[model samples]
Structure formats: C-alpha cells, structure tokens
Target: MVASSILSPAIADSLYAQSPFHSDQHDARTGKFWMTSHPTEPGDNGVVPLMKHWGGEVASMWVRDTELLAPLREIGRPRIIEIAVPLATTPDSYSAAKAVVATFGRSIGAIPGKGAFDLYTNQALPPSAVLAIHTEGDPTFVAMGRTYPTGFVDVDAGRWKELTGEDD
Candidate 1:
C-alpha cells in the first residue's frame, strides 16, 4: 500500500457525476441500479472502458477496509477509498499500485502518519469485476461493488441502503 490522501464523500460524488462518462442504468441481470460509464464495446460491460479512463490496466476492485480507517481518522479524514487492480504478476501489481498512488494520491490529501493509502492489485480476479468505494461514517454513500458484470461510478442512497441493509 502506498501513502495516499482522502476526499469527503460529497466531493467524490460530485467529481464522479461531473465526469464525462457518467451513466445511470439498471442491470436486468442483477436487478440493481448503477451510475457508471457507457460500455466501450458492443455486448460488453463497461469495466474495460472505465479502467482505461481511470488509468488502470485491467479490471480492479476498490474496497474500503474498516481496519485501515484508524490512521486516516487520526488525521481528521474518517473515510477511505481504495482501488484494487488485478494484474498478472506481483511486479505488475506493484507498478500499478505506484501509478495509482501517483495519479490519484496527490489530488486527495495525504495520510499524516505511516501513509495508509491501500492501493493494490489482485492476480486472481475474475472477468467483469465490480469496483466499490467504501466509507466509514457515511452510510448514505456506497459507491460501487462487484456481483455484477460492469464497474460502477456511483450508487444512489435508497439502493445503497437496500443492498447493505443500512438504516438512514
């Protein structure tokens, strides 16, 4: 994991919505709503195009781990957003991690102590994986998750609570 920064969910949401490729569509196969990019290829999910736009080589998973939230909290950033890219080799993962850190770490704020940005790459991820943005205190914002064919840019509040069983 590289040292990284933080962004409030509101800011993240705004940035994502303002992105040129944003989309909101319901997946009939999974019966879920997604705010994501349009598919780059016909009959293809949006993962490939999203990764390309986001500067990731292959499909990746972004998770917010509760365990890593402490260090960020100490700096007054109680929320964390992680990006996990899947690669074919360990070296590739490391390089990708560095790229992610370089590309996104600066725009957000840096972690004060020990640099707790946890960006990694997985070698075992299946095709068309979902990437999620997880936060600690904000239950109203659950960015995205897998169990679907395409990647997601954001998810609405009602759907988030419905999926996670979280109360407002």
Candidate 2:
C-alpha cells in the first residue's frame, strides 16, 4: 500500500531545523546542502526502518524495522543527514529504490531485513536522499530493495556527547 501522508520539503526542513542535533554541509558537487542528524537519544533502542524522500516525493522501504544503533557503531557517528531533492513523483515499492538508482546513474546499496542502518557514502549525494524509515510492525520479515545515502561525513563522538549531554 502507498503512504497516505506525504511531507512537504518546507515542513520537513522546518521540523529538521528545530532539532539542535541537525546539521548540513554545502556539497560542491550538487550545489545544495546535504543535511544529517543524530535524532535519537543515548540509550534509545528500537527498530528504525528505511525511508526515502526525493525532491518532494516520499517512499518507505519495504522492510519494516532495523536496528538503530548498527549504523552509528559501524559508521563512527557520522552526521545523519536528511536527503532532500527538488521535486518529483515516483511510485512507491521497489520502484522507489530504482528511482534513486536512475537519478544517480549508479548502483545503490541495500540494507538487509535484519541489517542495521549502516550504509555510508564518501561522495556527495544527489538531491534525492534516504532516511530512517519509522514504522510499526514485526521486525523479522524479509525486506525488499531499500537504499541509503552513499556519502556521509564522520563526526566526533566525544564532542557530540558533550554538546548534547548524551552519555554513551
């Protein structure tokens, strides 16, 4: 089934801006800021599904849930930025993943059903981007094609903790 609620870029950006943990960097390659955040509190444990927002269109990964901490442990606490694009209408389901590949003209990585959100990128991402897909359901089912950002910058864990008062 398709998502009944679609978030506008302005609303998304406003919500993102409200978070002190949110940050973005100017991407010379795309000429737009790539945003990321550490949106969870320390000791927060739960399954975070994968979601994608391209331009203005939003899509949820077929997989329902994934470990939230896996990516942080694997990627060394990089700024978890939101992926935003100009605007486009893309179908949901596997087509969402395909749309990302088509937009970037390259193969994208897929986070397995039981996998953590651990994908990272060393390059600048296209306007279309991925985020933790938040949803409710069983966490043990097989996942369809799901993609995440291929580029991300690492952040200092100690400094982040100091700033946010989050104890590890």
What's each prediction's TM-score? 0.17, 0.18
Per-residue error for 18 in candidate 1, Å, reads: 42
Q: Score each candidate by Cα lDDT.
A: 0.34, 0.31
Model 2 per-residue lDDT tens digits across residues 1-168: 113234445444543454323323223212333222223321233223222222211222221223322221332222233444323422222444544444344234332222113232344555456534332231211121222222321223244465568876
Give the worst 10-residue stretch by lDDT in candidate 2.
138-147
In TM-score terms, candidate 1 sits at 0.17
> Where does candidate 1 stray beyond 4 Å?
1-74, 82-84, 89-130, 140-168
For model 1, name the residue pairs that clash: 5-109, 132-144
Which structure among the candidates has the greatest TM-score?
2
Residue lDDT tens for model 1, 81-113: 332334442334554455456436444753212
Q: What's the true lDDT of residue 112 in model 2?
A: 21
